[model samples]
Target: MEVKVASPSASRRSSQTKKLVGGKRGCHVVVKVFPCKICFRPFTNGTSAHLHARTHLNSAELEKTSLFHAKCPHCQKMFFVHHHLTDHLFVHLSREERAEVAQGWRHGCYFCTKRFRVSSHLNLHLLTHTKEKLGGICHVCRKTFTSKQNLTRHGFAHLSEDEKIALVKQGRSRKCLFCQKKFPDNRAYHVHLVSHTKEKPFRCDHCGALFGLKYNLNKHKLIHSEDPRPFKCDKCDQAFSQKHHMTSHKRTVHRKLKDFACPVCGKKFGRKSHMVGHLRSVHAKIRHPSPHCGKTFTQKGHLGIHLRKLHPSEPSAK
Candidate 1:
């Protein structure tokens, strides 16, 4: 063994094997390793690694350049080139459905129960439910979604804490006019205003029930479909289809945590909506006057009660 000497080829092969096994132990032995700074892909030479790293840098630059291009005025979808964007405008023009396909179209499908920006996009998305090839797949859940937008939204659930925080910060530049509340985006601010107006645009087709939020409409539809209640109460046998309902039940019934306190009456409410309703009934200005006695009340219920008790034969003033 003392007289034996390894050949140059054997020494080179050993070094190659060590470089191939680029773990902590092997990396310590390989002194001349040309590891890529971007992806850490090990290379035989520094020049090769540097060239490979430049490809990633070029891709990042291309993405930045693409973002600098003009976006569609209607859909706000970005275009890498002006000609491609001009061609996209024709799709919006010369159509009866053009009015509905405006900036905040929010096209929804009845079949897959998914929402989209444009009706034509929704039509194309519907084909995915019937065909396998067009289906959008989520890598994290391994589930198939009808549209890419739905899949993107599904991906948000898998985001890291830092990524989620950054995304929240990106959208939080806008503020609400009524409460001066800060929202992440304009869409969120509009949705929040629905609470103040008490406007219920999302309606259930099955039961003819109405909901202010699309999420609530989706949850309400589950009732007609007889979906299983996954979220259960720990103290009682009660279960709910939605997690927020379970949380609400727990806070109101079990925990009894009245977090939302009424500013006018000093009354505590388990939910913010309940507190808002209380404020509207007790503290809000009397807009609807009682035609029976020229008296005004904050709530419609109070006016109805006053009419029924005092002016029963007055034929119920409108």
Candidate 2:
């Protein structure tokens, strides 16, 4: 259950370096990191490496004390660490619901009667009732959003009345004649065109949402759904159902500053995914599914089951 952090050069280290540093440590493996002295292949992070190195300086008394800790709710067995408790809980969940509940304990948490689309939703929702509190606000509208992302979306409404009218008149949707592909935005359509021309011009500022066209970047903007979207608060940790609602709440109540920008067109994007999608459609030549797959995905939920039955491991229709 102990998750290890992988080092940047773990694969390239040599055994000779391990022997030089580890010496007579009881651990069977002798591993070393190329550049980082505190990191090695055998241990995931600097903390583990330092802890292991401690064994060389002392014996049993100096070693981290092995002790009994948390108890399992069902089996009544004691675990040595919190992770072991977590692993045992997973096993319990996988089997307990099948036996304990007479009918079925719906997908919602036992404590809250609220239903969720997925267990992940329930888990995140549980955080609200728990001790976790992360929130945000919008500066222009003086509104409060549950998360930072909602505030960003609210800023979109602050765009000039002229710009909103212009975008609406332009028709946000379009199609690529070359690929015969349809997209929700014109920028996406153009990005698809660049793929045939082989261009990879723009790079994502945060990570790798790179693209060859500005519009493609715009289309990518709709992809990321923040935790506190419509009513939530955190920028990265909260979840939400709608972007506009979140933004409105932030600006009207909390006074959050807007800082989103488009990487391809140099225009500002209200949200990050909007920009990424624009870049992807215009410049990135993504291979669409075969016509057969497209035909099977006429409905949203049906597409999930179709892809699951056909390509169980690939992206599902959902």
Candidate 3:
């Protein structure tokens, strides 16, 4: 899945650049910003990101030299790294549940259910827990938030309450007629308008990917670099190109602790297809019948899959 596109000479890139940047700086590509998946810390290169990732894993991870794979019970997502999986598991638990785990596993590792004999051994295990201390207080408004990003976003509201105003006036009255979203100025208003249309003007010179926004296209171009995956799950030797992808890989594949449940008959399954099959038998009736063959299917997706596989030239549905 690696796609390579030429430099500024490409058609998509030149067209996207003019529509996006709309200025003399259209030729320049977006700057690279590498953020750590675990802590959201930004770094310039993969070596630093890889080095920092080692901090998230316990020393025990190294002693055991074997392949490791973790799967989230709820969504059936898979993760390659142990510490990433452990760090992801907390998001699925409520505050009370998390506190319970922290207390109960205080003398043990909650993620792997591994108990330690010594107090210092348990203390070392705490480093693997990635969830930050929950209560973050805002300096200006004295407001509380769950994470640093929320606090930072909340702080923007108080940027200029009364005393001074920004030189470039924000037209709060300037609203998008189509979506009812407020915009600060004409430039922003026009940018918002692009989302309504099927047009994606922003372009990446390296890969020639199209994006509606310059910000997103610029962010996408970073993937073309030699070392796109700065963040590394050193525990499992897995590398992630994007920080969010790594976080999501951990959260969805590792932290989830329960199999997916069928709403109709209260059946649980590790795979989604199995649950769907359960629904087809108990709740849904076999309605979709094949024209050529005598076989019938309970769902359109199943029938479509059958058609694509067996009858390659036939239309999927009647």
The true-versus-predicted C-alpha distance at residue 94 of model 1, in Å, is 26
Ranking of all predicted structures according to TM-score, beginning with the best and ending with the worst: 1, 3, 2
Better of 2 and 3 by lDDT: 3
lDDT of 1 by residue, 1-318 (tens): 012122223123212222234445543333354544333445667898667644433233445643445545543433445666665574545333444454355777768655666577788877755654345786643556666755665577556556666664554233443465554443454567667545454556666676767787777777666556878899999989887789789878998877666767888888877887788867775355789678887667777888888888887643
Candidate 3 per-residue lDDT over residues 1-318, each given as its tens digit: 222222222122111111223346544343343433333334556677547644433445435678475554532333457765665565455446666677655466767666554576665555456454354887643545556645654555444423113312332223444566544433454467557533454455555567767677656866777787876764457778777567645544566423446766776664556677778766876478777685888776777878778888766442
Each prediction's TM-score versus the true structure? 0.33, 0.23, 0.30
Pitting candidate 2 against candidate 3, the one with the higher TM-score is 3
Model with the higher lDDT, candidate 1 or 3: 1
After the best TM-score superposition of candidate 1, give how far the Cα of residue 242 lies from its true spot, in angstroms.
3.7
- CA-lDDT, candidates in order: 0.59, 0.46, 0.53
In candidate 2, how many Å is residue 275 off?
Answer: 3.1
Cα distance off (Å), candidate 2, residue 309: 26
- Greater-TM-score candidate between 1 and 2: 1
For model 2, residues 1-318, the per-residue Cα lDDT tens digits are 122233333234322233332335533453443322212225445565546534322232245576434545543433445765664464434223534542343566667656654575676677566634344666643456555544554555656556555544455433343454444343344346556534444444435666656455544544643432344655444544555556544643365433444445665444455455545555453334433455433233455556667767653433
TM-score, candidate 3, is 0.30
lDDT of 1 at 195: 75
